[model samples]
Target chain A: MRYAMVIDTLKCVGCSDCVVACQTENDVPHGYCRDWVTESVIGTYPEVEIELRSERCNHCDNTPCVRTCPTAASHVIEGGIVLVDRDLCIGCGACIESCPYDARYRHPEWGTVDKCTFCVHRVHKGQDPACVSVCPTNCMYFGDIDDANSEVSKLIAVRKYKTLAPEAGTKPQIYYLI
Target chain B: MIPFQISGSEEVFISGRNIPHIDPHLTLWEFPISLYLFLGGLSAGILFFSAVVHLINKEDEFKGAAKWAPIVVPFALSIGLLALVYDLGNPFYSWRLYTTIRLESPMSWGAWVLLIVTPLSILWVMTYIRELFPVIKYENYKMPFLYKVEELAVKYKKYMALALLPLTIILGIYTGILLSAFNARPLWNNAILGPLFLVSGLSTAAATIILFAKSHHERQWFSKIDILLIVIEIGLIIHLIMGYYAGNEMQIEALDVLMNGEFTTMFFGLLVVLGLLVPLILEVFELAGFKVPVIIPAILILIGGLIFRILMVEAGQLSRILY
Candidate 1:
């Protein structure tokens, strides 16, 4: 069963609680993040509208990070959660180079490549990711795409969703609702 | 957490969260490590090239290059490996580079290439060492088996030359491809980089030959080759710069960064002037009626080539306009 996060940008408050939750849950290094928020303002003066984008590993169906990693240290898991094996990672930064989204980072302490694992450690035990659980505005939806009754599947059926950089051909599992 | 400042306009925000973005100042550190890698690979490839050509032609003028190529290529490669290790935070775990093979990745290709070429090149050198050094030929004691191997190298020099040529071309071009793979990074995504790197390999290879050639005849012939390589390199630079100029805003911005931003001085001062210009001027002098030695120009060109790689890598990484 594939798992994915569908983020509704109109519903997002830009609170950064998800960023905090993901970092604390994963113990990610300083100056590096598995999840990040970017804000873009369109138009000038009174007509301006703010667009917020939260980015992480797309958990691509055809992951470029895996293709670019010299060692099999970076690979996609069963749910298509692209994860890095810290023990096997040489901290070469090649995966970082290969990733178009710039979702991964070389950890200062671990000295290995690290990225969003979809909180796999938590998801493996049948729980929502820290970001999904902690999100105050209910902007994040996480569930198995395989289950027709799952919340994510139901949301995908009902909502208009889009993926970032669709031209990249990676088939990102993360869906954004505009 | 900083607020956007617009002149002659009141502060306006539709949402509670402020728009925050990284300043242009925050970029990946200009790590000098890649330069070492590029230079080492170029030097090794060039030396290997010189070795192959000299081994085939076997002219008296090319003998010094033939002898030095085997010694110098491996040494430069060893130094490149050391530089890469030094750049790593965990050098001990560098072995992990060899643990996998993802053909699509340049690093993966490079890692495997290095792994195979380094040892093979070293063995290739060892196979010819006794011939290069007369002292090794008449050592106090020698094995008959070793003599048989030496006989083999002499017999198969043509085959070894053919093998080393393709390997050298691959080594030279792969570095350029590594930089070009980052398509999002427009500064480095140019197709010309492969040819640029090929010329760089030739340029540095000639520099190395000039640095070590013991005989006047060998030095003169190599200097001619070095001068030719330098000319070709200048032509490639002009072509690349023209491409950069005529491209889109991103490419133009990148060129601006190299021509007028923080990296401007280094790019023009070190890479263009010290590296390319001075060396070219010196070569021109020798080509004209001047009687100066080629040693100074060779040294300048060598230093220039090293600095050129460093500047290109740094400028490319630092000038990224991430949206």
Candidate 2:
């Protein structure tokens, strides 16, 4: 099953609650983050438009990180969720260079590359990812996109949305409803 | 109501990303990777020249290229491998690179190539051990086993050369492919990187031969080859820039990084002018019977080759497609 995330940009307030939730859930180092909030201000002053996005790994179907990795450290598990095997990783940082979203980071303490896993542990236990659960604006939705009945699939099918860097042809799973 | 409008005056500002490595630039790879690529290319070039000389039966006339230069390959490769290991975050798990091979991964291809080529290089050098050092007589030292292995190596030296010819080409191209495979990095996504790196490697190897060769004839022979390779390298660089300039938005921005960005002076002044052009002109004059010291151009080419790699790695990381 292809798991995916749908984020409603209009509902997001740029409060960064998802960013804090991910760090606390993953125990990420202080200076590093697995997810981040970005505020894009476009156009000149009086005619400007602002977009607030909570961004993380796209967990692409054609993941360059998995393809470029020297060892099989980076791999896509069931549900098309890209994950890193810390034990097998030589930590060469090739995957980091190949990522288009700038999603992955080298963990300072573990010395291995780390990124958002869609909170696989929580997902397996029938719960939403920390970021989705903690988002007060209820802007985020997560489910198996492969399942026609899933919320994520329904949202993507009914709404006009966009994915980052479509020209990259990575087939990113994250959808942002404009 | 009609309002006056300015064309293409919109600006975009992004905030809250401020990530150290990912935001300002990608610094995941540093000097160690550049050194490894340089030394790896140098080793490939040395092996290529030595093997070709052996295959062509010019070992007697070009003793320096065939024997002395091959002697340096193993040492250079060893140090390069050490630099690679040092660059790894989990170097202890480096053995994992060999557990399984991913054909799509250039890094996997490099690891496998090095695994085979490193030992083969040592064996190639072993064949010339006695000729390189006359003082250590293996007969008197009671190392008949060592002597026998050396004898076998010399007997099958031609076969080793045959194997090395293609492997050297692969190794040379692999250095460039490693960087170019990162499609997300706009500056490194160009296809010309492969041949550019290969020609640079050959040129650097020729310079090294010029530096090490004892005979004037051997030095001049390689000097001419280096001049040709330098010209090809310049042509490739021009094509690379032209391709980037005509590419999409990200590629155009990537070209800006080299042409007008922070790397402009280093890329143009050091790599193009001083590294490749100056050395090319000097080598040309040297061929014309001018009393130019061969070492000057040789050293300049070596330094320039190294600077080219460092700039490619650093600037390529700084130029991203998503940004």
Candidate 3:
């Protein structure tokens, strides 16, 4: 299945629910968050609008992270989720360095790098990721793009969507609706 | 926008080191550690090439086959690894690099390659260990693995040379590719980096091999190799620096960091002087029919190569663009 996520910037309140949800689920190392919020602001306070974009690993299909991996530790999983094998990782941080988005983190205990995996564990258990479940704004959506009946696929079909860093050619899984 | 604490107008953090009021958005790991990898790989590559030439080609025709090939391989490989480990933040964890495989990372690939090549190389040199030290042979019997490798090298000398050629190229190219893989760092993002590294590897490897061989005949063969390698290196450096100058604003800024910033001293002083100039001088002496021995030039060349790696890695990292 071609798993995908679409984040609606207008609906996001920048409450950081996604960050907390991600941290709890992944046991992310302190001083590092798998999912975070980016804000772009313009003009004075009276006229200003803080544009918030929730960011995480795009899980690109043509990942440079995969290309730079010497031991084949970081890879794309069966369901199109890019995963890092903690067992095989040597904590060399090459993948982390290669990642343009700053999505990856070096786990304190694992010693290897970790990043958003599109909630691969939850998918295996037939459940939604904690962040999707916890997002009160319903700004985040995830489903198989192959299943046209799925809400995510239908929404993507009907709306104009964008992915981060198109020049990178990773074919990012995360779609942003403008 | 979320507030970012900047102590200066454009201060940046590069590889955990803070550069105040510098290029605030660039982050690169062009460190001593990274440079050592490049040098070490080059050293290994040169030895591989030299050994191949010695093993496959008619040694009777070559001037310094017996003395130089045997001496250069082990010494360069051994010292190269020493420089590598010494540059690491935690050298002990280096062993753990072998316990796992991460094909996505060039350093991990390099680590594995080094592991395989180091021991194989050591064994290859041990073929002449008896000649180097006759008493050591009588002290201990040979291990089965070492004996088997010796047999393999002798039996499939041509095949080994062919096999080693590609591996050496890969080992050399991977050094530049390792840094190039990081697109976030504009200085390392150039396509020419791989070729630049390949040339640097060949030149440095030549310097290292020349440094260790002591005899006159050995010096002649090594000087010949050095001349060819150094010319290629100079050409590549010109291309790389020129490309940096001709590229976009970011590339030029990065280049400025090398030419005029913190790395200026090392780049102009150590890498240019020790790595390029002195070695070139030694080569000229050889070309002019002077009677310089192999030891001094060989030592100077090796020192120059080491300094070059240090300069490249440090100079390349002086600019910071990412916070």
lDDT of each: 0.72, 0.89, 0.66
DockQ order of candidates, best first? 2, 1, 3
iRMS for all predictions? 5.8, 2.8, 7.5
Provide DockQ values for all models, in the order shown. 0.35, 0.58, 0.19
User: Which residues of candidate 2, in runs, are more than 4 Å off?
Assistant: B1-18, B137-144
Q: Encode model 2's per-residue lDDT on B191-269: one tens digit a residue.
A: 9999999999999999999988879899999998999999999999999999998898788877887899899999999
Between prediction 1 and prediction 3, which has the larger lDDT? 1
Best by DockQ: 2
Predicted candidate 2, C-alpha RMSD: 3.8
lDDT of 3 at B153: 65
Q: Model 1, B53-89: lDDT tens per residue?
A: 5566863557556666557677778888787776664
DockQ of predicted candidate 2:
0.58
Cα lDDT of model 2 by residue, A26-144, tens digit: 99887677888776666767887877788899999999999999898999999999999999999999999999888898888778899999999999999999999999999999999
Itemize residue pairs with steric clashes in candidate 1: B275-B304
Residue A151 in candidate 2 has what lDDT? 91
Model 3, A61-108: lDDT tens digits are: 888787776667778878788898876665556676667666776665
lDDT by residue (tens digit), candidate 1, A1-178 = 8989889888887888888888789886655667877566766778877767677788988776787777788888787788888778877666766665767766778777778899898998999999889989999999888899988888889988888766666688888887
